[model samples]
Target: MPVYKVYLDQVFLGNLVMNYAILWAAAKLSRVPVHTARLVAGAALGAAYALAVFIPGAGFLQSVWFKTVISAGIVAVAFSPVTVRMFLTCLGCFFLASFTLGGLAIGIIFYLNSGRLSSWDGIGKVIEGNFWPGILLGLIALWAAGRGFAALLKKGKFENLFRIPILINSGGKQVRVEALLDTGNQLKDPMTQSPVVVVEYNSLKSLLPEQVQAGLERDGEADIWNILGSLSESSLSSRFSAVPFQSLGRANGMMLGFRPDEVVIERQGKLARPGRVVVGIYRNKLDPEGSYHALLGPNVLELTG
Candidate 1:
């Protein structure tokens, strides 16, 4: 008879980390906001499930139905308030990431030491005590693969305009809004050469001064110009600028632009700062359907970290 010793701490900790990674990857794939504390709590739930097999009367945990329920529970905890479509997408990505990583680890372990690999119980057993180095190397490989995949996607079918979440912070005020990445948008501030992100005036209303808001509420280029001229004597003169643009039915138009303290774009579970960017205020709605409130220039995405 042969015996296998599984460290309980390793089982809990290993599954915890693995669960977190899978949840994060799934969130990125589903393009949803990530809550770190919720993810950690969800991972803890998964780790608890992994330990249930050790209990005397916990045989029900091994059933396929029970396993499905647990998986759903994990996702619900991590990404609550998701629609049915989004929930399905998140679950699919979760399974895909889990299978891909699990299969890769198993293949590598088998290729290295087929004789030592016998029965797979918990994830800790697959990692064992001596396989930490291989795991670390595998993580590095996955990261490189992810970067390459992102580049390929950019040039692939996803090159078209897509919605993304962005945060604009100025004067200790931050506004989070959905923005469309427009490849056709090449608008930039002529003075500083910073890319201009056109946001609906209502979307940025909270961040603007009372005088600026008053001017934006009115129509016509004359009022906009008046506001720009008036701001020179105001305290916000340094933060304001003029961005010239040409659009359909409008030529040589100027937009009210202001410099934000910081702009952070979240893509694939990562925060990308596109250096300095100007926020252009548009009095009218950019999208009639209200799908997105802001427009992002392609160059900004390229400069993101």
Candidate 2:
């Protein structure tokens, strides 16, 4: 057996520092609103708990359930007025931030002590090497990473980070795809002048008749409007439309469009329907990895709000 001792003042100080770090990291990573006074008070309360739990008669504080409740209290005080879903999201980010900071601290400590640890014989010294430097460096690295991520989000690619599920119901046949919201998509229906969602040929090909698919395959998009005309006799006649546009290195281009009976967007456990939108068919893959099968333009994507 080994002897163990913890000082009250040390526990209080350590917990204060750690709680603030965790709170800051979680807020930055999770994008949760922060009230400075509330957060500071919450961290202080957490530190008080640390000191309180170490008191000689505090046996109940050692239980896992008690600790979990304590964590919830700390989070609630720090980020008040948060929805349950958002609170859970913040809690997950808190855990992630804690783990990442721990790993970062440990890695820096190990790196700083590498080859110089030959004189030390115990695990305590190995794990506890140069605490202040490790903490300072870890925090600096965290801040830098947060800044880099924020910069990336500001680069007009924020919409591409999340994939939204959209269901297209045409003539009773429904096709669903994960859509990447593209800010650069300016394609719109020339007639109604509504927004258009660009989808791959393969994904929406099932929504078309076999004859139309054969015509598109034969003439390679040149006969897409003709194919839509032929589909006039089929069940998918009115669902088909066309759009004309000009792009880089190409002039006088046309894309096949589909006017589905209903277009539903699934996001955050809610389904939304947007009006005056057409689906544009793309001949090639928007993303080669197939991470998202469809691309949503701003005109229609805003309707999800």
Candidate 3:
């Protein structure tokens, strides 16, 4: 396999400079942090430019308009579906700067070498003549231009957090659950300091018998086995467990119901044990239209080290 070096020449410099400008414009228009926008734009543009120039059949489409369209595609990929006016304005500004400055540099090199205005061959010669120097100049120019544009735009905080999806049993049926892992939810039993998980009462109604549900609604708490008897006469008391929890700034005990199987959480195409978390059934919806069936509390400890 032959490895091709990415040459830093006049053409490369021009492309990089225009790409940086386009990236800065995208960050401003999208209201995203500049570094993130730049990273996305740079990756997109670099790949597209490489494809356009190096792919065997692609070289035939080389033109200013063609390259501009390619650059626009990169911008679109980096920041999907911006307003048409903003897209056009940013693209237009980048195009003008790229063509004018790049064309001027090419023109200067031609004049210095041949001393006369001529044809496209003159521009090509200019590029070939000062290839290495142009690469260095282009990198410096791109950095300076990017910094200048970024200084004028507002900056935002960027956070990268992990999120996991959970599965829970509701009303004797399995339902998919989504929950946020918040380290800030440090509620625990005052006696044990074991983390408290909160759930709405309405969520567990399907699992509870009518009488038990009514009792909870009337008094806000119910004896654990009293409700289980409504579902079965046999001793199901072993299944009805309680995990201590603190809520509303007060320490209390939470009744825990169990499913025969272990709950699994899927993240990034892999499965993991979230913890031996007790399910808390809530009466009201956490978010009425949200997809999550229940929320997992911090009391759940990881099954693995």
User: Best candidate per lDDT, number?
Assistant: 1
Error of 2 at 260 (Å): 16
191-253: candidate 3 lDDT, tens digit per residue: 334334445566445555465566567665566555656646534444344454444334565
Which regions in candidate 1 have their CA more than 4 angstroms from the true location?
A: 113-135, 147-157, 161-305
Best by TM-score: 2
Tens digits of per-residue lDDT, candidate 1, 98-211, equal 776676665676566666666665445656653755555555555556566656644444533387899999889899989987644667788898888889889999999888
Candidate-wise lDDT, in order? 0.78, 0.76, 0.52
Clashing pairs for model 3 are 200-281, 200-282, 200-283, 201-282, 201-283, 202-282, 202-283, 203-282
Give the Cα error of residue 300 in candidate 2, in Å.
Answer: 16
TM-score for predicted model 1 compared with the true structure: 0.50
Ranking the candidates on lDDT from highest down gives 1, 2, 3
**Cα lDDT of model 2 by residue, 236-281, tens digit:** 6776787876541256888888787778998778889996678887
TM-score of each: 0.50, 0.52, 0.35
- Judged by TM-score relative to the true structure, which candidate is superior, 1 or 3? 1
